[model samples]
Target: MRTLIFATAIRILTPLFLVFSLYILLRGHNHPGGGFIGGLMGSIAFVFHTLAHGTKQTAKSYFSLTFYKYDRKPHHNNLSHALRLLRKNIVRNKKEKPIFIWNYYLLRLRPTYLMAIGLAVAVGSGLVGLVMGKPFMAAYWLKVKIPLVGSVGTPLLFDTGVYLLVLGMVLKMVFTMSKD
Candidate 1:
């Protein structure tokens, strides 16, 4: 099957993928690659690793509880860990895969439930605040005052929320699709 060969390729590609993903992630603030795309590449690399080895190996090498939630410490190590596990779910179903019900949608289990919930909270709060000022994506969001973080002058936190939400959702979808 392609899984075994893919596994070998995974070993070969993981390191390179990781290095490149990191480069992309770090440059995201200034360039086009940013956290979301960078996180996606990192997640794909880990998925390849998982396919080559197994979920247990994948979990040890990649997933952990620390990555699921948030970290208050300095630096962005948690983001790396979180992205790796975000989309990790059943890629190949041991049982029969379900057929799509319609073109409208299909159903699958997602692993980043908590992260999604948190994103909803942050985004909900952020939107309420944004509407109070100027409801626009590029209209100087940072200038809008937040009650806790500071005066209306920093939308970085909102961006962070979006990043987390997308990262978790994308990874979860990938993992689920693979499992199917």
Candidate 2:
């Protein structure tokens, strides 16, 4: 049932998102965007994918999110939020009932698990460095000193770990939530 027009449009747009995301992440090294924003942008591809195919099929593209995982209680907390967020714009803008708002707020994690992972990674990396005997958990500086940023120090490793953790979790979250 795929229309030629829809297929052509998606084909053109997916690569566009990927290219733009790469630019943002690379340029972000000194300016604004970075791997974190890049990850979210790249993740939007799957959201668009979900729109093209149904959720069950789209789920295949998100490797980490197993469809069967929801079988234990189908209506798990995160799953509920995922469905709600995905359907929000479609329903609300279509003049649907407002009651769904209540469900949205109720199931949505206050800070979301993505944020939690970032925090944990940062803290854990820093703590581990301290135990390693480098004062202030020297991450980059412990190894070598750069120019303007001072010794990269433990903060850099902590920051890097957190950055990676945040990006991975956010990308996964956005994809899973975009299900149709």
The candidate that achieves the highest TM-score relative to the unseen native structure? 1
Computed on alpha carbons, the lDDT of every model, listed in order, comes to: 0.56, 0.56
Query: Model 2 over residues 44-140: C-alpha lDDT tens digits?
Result: 6655655676455544444334222223244545877668757875567655655332211112222245567667766776676578776554454
- Ten contiguous residues minimizing lDDT sum, candidate 1: 99-108
Error of 1 at 132 (Å): 9.4
As a TM-score, model 2 comes out at 0.42
Write one digit per residue (lDDT tens) for candidate 1, span 1-180.
347678778888988987776566555544443556766776777677766776556655555533233333454357774464443333545574442222323233244863676487446656765676756443234556445334432244444444556556666765666652
Q: Model 1: residues >4 Å from true position, as ranges?
A: 1-16, 31-33, 65-110, 114-159
Q: How much is 141 displaced in model 1, in angstroms?
A: 9.9
For all predicted structures, in order, the TM-scores are 0.45, 0.42
